[model samples]
Target chain A: MSIPAIASTRNDALASLLDNAINNKTKPLGSLGMLETVAKQIGLIQNTRVIALEKPAILVFAADHGVVAEGVSAYPQDVTWQMVENFLARGAAINVFAQQNGCALHIIDAGVNHDFGPRTGLTDRKLAHGTHNFAQQPAMSSDTCATALAAGMALVAELDGNVVGFGEMGIGNTTAAAALMHKLTGIPVAQCVGAGTGLSADGISHKQRVIEAAVALHASATEPLDVLATFGGLEIAMMVGAMLKAAERRMVLLIDGFIVTSALLVAARLQPAILDYCVFAHCSDESGHKKMLDNLGARPLLQLNLRLGEGTGCALALPLLHAAVNFLNQMATFESAQVSEKSE
Target chain B: MSIPAIASTRNDALASLLDNAINNKTKPLGSLGMLETVAKQIGLIQNTRVIALEKPAILVFAADHGVVAEGVSAYPQDVTWQMVENFLARGAAINVFAQQNGCALHIIDAGVNHDFGPRTGLTDRKLAHGTHNFAQQPAMSSDTCATALAAGMALVAELDGNVVGFGEMGIGNTTAAAALMHKLTGIPVAQCVGAGTGLSADGISHKQRVIEAAVALHASATEPLDVLATFGGLEIAMMVGAMLKAAERRMVLLIDGFIVTSALLVAARLQPAILDYCVFAHCSDESGHKKMLDNLGARPLLQLNLRLGEGTGCALALPLLHAAVNFLNQMATFESAQVSEKSE
Candidate 1:
């Protein structure tokens, strides 16, 4: 399976132009702080001073995780499909936030165990019923992982947007993400594991043990794709594909919390330049997420302590993106506003 | 001067109901993080489980400070009126953000040194040409201070909104805010002073010295009103009145950076219950802002390193307020979505 090439958005000339435009705005230099950085990033990604976020979309991929059989998650595996139904019915947090922020929501079934026939808002892209239990064996065959990635890429290719936010609903997938994070980033399984969906102390310990055993079993899978195939959920693999494709298309990629960032870890390893098009939405309340973000040298836009992940962080953070771009495009320069600059 | 009585929004029965409503939403309990707190706060403020934020408006009080002559700020005092003109022209940061976030922007002339005979969209409420230089004397007389406070209260009384965000534009206002912070919080003058619009180290030291001398001269003014009269800018005094009035009316007061928060400090001192009505927008990059927020025992929603004082922080954070309310109202319950709860 061939990964699309993402070009480096490192244009010194364009960077200078963006800086000039941002600095001349009718406020103190760097007083806008992180917003100036965001505006510059968006400008760089678009390769233009006039940045436009057109047809912003959030694709929430849902699937089941075989890791659920190990009692790693607080909720049953059925909650995955139930939450997807909630998304379709417009009753989920992601649905409400996406609607509030004017982003179109697309719910995709990557590899859920249940079969829903001909649903209106649900996009069918299932690679299988679910991955095999990684605690006992590899999650998916190499071909299946490739197929999931390709499907994700194809979905973005057909979408009508220059920006896409990645979200996921997969019961027990945090276990999968933890395992993937451990293998890919060389972090200990214990450090990668967390109280996913409200696990108790003992439950978290047991979850860590389960992931440790899985990581030890899949120790030979050192390459990015091999590590992903061994431990990644179908939804995660697909998100990896979607993120890569979005970056390759020069669309701004809004990345949510742990599970989504785990996919990004894989995508970034495959093509490092994809980081240029990516925006780390928030540092979630989920344990090890900050470390995961730190590992990638990412500074997230918000740290709202959000742990519920149907790309809710991404949806919440979309406004900051708009604010960043709006300030860049609409704010007056010191010259334009006739405001005095800093004292010489 | 009559300060409006602010009733505490503390109802145990209603708090229980708001918690039940929030926890029953289709997400993990406390997963929404600060947003959950904001939702509950709004619910309690409105005295109902069904929370609604209507006709949100950002009132930007623009003024000029006499303290600018003491070399306490980086920009000239005239920039205050210029930025206000920028706001009126819809080309300021606050205007751009407020417009993008569906917030009505109100530009009020609290005490700018300049004057336009008649301008559309500019609310004229000048207390004086500007405050008297606090370094040499009191910023305002007891009567003038009282009048400023009354003017702020009267302005909010006529505004048609359940939510009001406070922003300000005044050169050298941060110097005034630092003085207010020093006096109200008993924090050291050096700790409270910072780079207001790009002050150098020497400039910050000079600002600190100016504030320290002024603070010493006003040492006898221990009462909040007397302290405000001694140190606060007209915009800050007006904001104090506006904040108290807004709280008395139970409007969600979205408080901006250091200067706006200084106004809140005075408001909270006079009516301690007013803190309950405030939504601290962001912990600005402006030095001493974090300390000021800490002094109020307030946890702000966003910390984007924004130091611009045009209520840009308030406008930027408005979407999160909407999201918090939206999620509370729209999301499904565990039973409603048929999503399984945590395993026993």
Candidate 2:
């Protein structure tokens, strides 16, 4: 399968208009700082001087990765399914943040091992229940990778908002994300690996070795999807597909953490245009996230050291998106407020 | 009048409980990142594991400084009264952000040169129609400084919230804040001066020169109050008073921008315990703000490069305060979610 076409480019005319509009707002010019940047980016993306985030939603993909068997994660593989249930029950940190920020949440089971079976708010689009252990074999076939990507794209197409945040929950997926980062960026696996789910120093080194061995096995994989099929989790593939679709639909894609960004790296390689639609939510303390963000030249909204991958960063940044839009629309201009501008 | 004593120390016992509670959240340990730090700080401040921000108010003090006559700021001093009027009309950035975050805003006429007679939502606490020309003479008499401090203390006493944010509006007050920062932190005047209200490079140098000249004039002023009386704007003096009162009452104080922190430096000096009650809201783009934050060993929640300085930073951060408190109070524990904890 080929990468989907993304044709939208940022509207420079609207961006300049936003700049003038933001500067004329009763405050000092450029005093809104990063908010002015946010306002401009959104205005340019939507191609409008009048911008607002309407019906924002968080799309969270949950799956299992084959690498958990290598003892790369501190939590057991079953915890993935258990946490998905927790998300369904609205009892996780993501749920609390989503509720706090008024963001609608849709959790997807891309390829978790357990059968959730017709749960509300859960999109069951499992890709072969779980991928093949990439340590011994390709994580999934090229066809399965395409299916996962299409599933993600389809899931996003069903969402109601023009702005959406992406997150994922899968034990050992960080190992997959790290491996993908290493393969794509060629940053060593040691720097890419981190203490996912609270691994100790020794555990991290061991996880590093597992990822390194897996990378060696997949030496023949060179294409983006081939690499994804080699080392990516099912959820990551879907997210890569969903991100492209979201960008195609011109939705604001809120990208979260290391796993989400690894998928984003795949999506970016597939279609560099997708970067225009993305807003990094935070810099996770998770290893390699900073490097990934640096590689993309993206500045995230928050830096809260959050490594929880269940779309929590997306939920946290929802209000900030609201502020950016609302400030652009609602803030009184100098003329409107009859306030004096700075004198020369 | 004497400086009010602030007796509140961070509650260590409750902090330990909060640490345990936060660590046991369904998310991985330390995964919540800055949110966990925020939760711990609030829990310690309130001396309770269960915390809530009730009746959060942004106390915005607006006054004029005599320093504007020296051409030390980018905007004319009349803009101070104009902005206060804008605040009352809900046409300012502070008003928009305050409304967005549901923070009750109390705009004070600390010493604006204009008479905004009998306005609702405007607290009339004039401090002698702004300060004297500090470049030529002491900005305020010691007697006026005492009255300003007492008024700020009285105003906080009348307010209904246990959580409050401090903000100020005064043209040329950045010069005053820079001068105050120079005096308190002993940093050079040039480093503390910046493009306040859109000053050009020449303007900043001129402002720096004006500040240096004033600091030289007040070389004999040694005590904090003496320094405040010598160089502080009425709003700064009042904020110092209000901050001390807020700390004495054990209310959480959200400190904003350069001018507000300059006032807080005075307050903290008067009573070191006041630092225990304060939360740095954002690192303002104002030149001296980072130094001021560093002087206090504070880590501000946001770094949006905002320099608008009307408690706007406080308002932007109000939702985050809510997130921190609500997440602590509302997120299901690992036990409640029945999710397995990270195995040792």
Candidate 3:
């Protein structure tokens, strides 16, 4: 099975019209800064000057990584299930922000070790107990990787929104993201690894060693899916699938922090058009986020030194999108408002 | 008349309580980043953990600086009154952002060179037609400066709110802010001046020379008020007054860009306690804004390279405050949520 094609390229034919729509607004040209860019991007994506972010939702995929047994995470692997429960109960930061920003949230259990039988809120799509420890062997088989991706695609296809955001929760996912980054970008593992949740200097060094060992073990994992199967979490694979499907549907995609961005890196590599539907939410304080962002040439909306990965950044940014959309839709043009323009 | 003493000190007594309140939230300690800082600051300012931002308002002071006659600005000085009209008509960027953020904006004719008698939406607080060209003589009389400050104080004193934001409109006020920054902080005029509205490199250099000339002519003006009388716009003086009074009333102040921060620099000098009430809304893309922020030790909430100075930054930041407030008031603690704490 293969990832779905992202067929919607930005409507460059409407570029001139969009510029006039933005510039003719009763303000100095480029005064709105990044907001103008957002308005224009959304307009181009939807192929209409009148852009609406409808039925916005944040899909948080939760799975555990077997590398937690190596003590790579600040929290134990059990916290993955615990955070999912917290999300369902509307107690996490992402939950509060999502509620505040009027975003519907869905928690998907891609491959958590725990078995929550028919939980009301969780979408149970467990691929297995968890991915195998990549430090010792491939994290998932290629078949398992494809299944996880398909789970993500299926989840997004069922969602009722043109604007979607992706976030993830896993105990040792950042370590996996780091290894993936190192392999994909050929950035050093030490540079890619960061103090996720919170790690001491020694622990980070130890993590680097573990990842270096893993990379050496999987030297032939050159293909994106092969690399993902070797080191990526099931949740990451699902997010990769979800992002592709969202783009294929011509929906606006909000990409969250380092872990999610790493997934995007894989997804973008597979189908480069996926990024055209995407807006980076914020630059994470995670050590390698800047490098990943730099490599992608993505300028995020906010940089609050946030390292929380529960789609909190996406929730925080939803209002900016609203503001941008509302301004474009509602603000009177100079001609309409009868405001005098600058004598050029 | 002297600047009113800012009587309210930060509630140090509640610092520990605020910390405990923040730490006890279900999220990890310091995970919220700037949101945690905002919550703590608001909590301390109100002297209560039950902090609420009531009746949020953005006071946009519109004035004209005589230095615009020297070609110190890219736009003609008439743009000040024109933009004020735009604000009233709800056609400007500030108006759009303010409306989007649920901020009740008050446009004050602090000293714009316009005679619009009894405009419905505008607050009539005209000090004079405009300030005197400080390049030729002092900008305003000492008595005028006193009255301007008093007017700012009176505006807030009459208004009913514990949270206020400030924005200003003037074509050459960036010149005034740069001059004030140079004089007050001993930073060079060349370093302080930036493209006001939209100036070419030659235009910026000319602005620098004009400011340097003014500074050389008024070398003896050391006191804050004297400095205001020598070189400040009426809007700047009024903002200085308003900020002091806002702090005195223990209201949370959302300070805007370079012009507002320059006014804040003056207010902070007159009474350093005023700094405690201000949350630098965004770091402006202007040349000297970073220096002003550094001098004040302010870490702004947003940095989208925004240089438009009509309290647009303040309007953008209001939602973050709401998010922070909502999270603190609404999120479940680890104990209440029955989530396990980190084992470290």
Candidate 1 Cα misplacement greater than 4 A, ranges: none
Q: Per-residue lDDT of B155-184 in model 1, one digit per residue for the tens?
A: 999989899999999998999999989889
Off by over 4 Å in 3: A8-10, B7-13
Candidates 1 and 2 compared by lDDT, better number: 1
Badly placed stretches (over 4 Å) of model 2 are: none
TM-score for every candidate vs. truth?
A: 0.99, 0.98, 0.97
Tens digits of per-residue lDDT, candidate 3, B12-114, equal 6798888888887776667788998898889888889898999999999989998888888777777788788878888777887888778899999999999
True contacts kept of 3: 0.52
- Clashing pairs in model 3, backbone N/Cα/C closer than 3 A: none
- Top of the candidates by lDDT: 1
lDDT of each: 0.92, 0.88, 0.88
Evaluation by TM-score, superior candidate among 1 and 2: 1
C-alpha lDDT (0 to 100) for residue B152 of candidate 2: 93
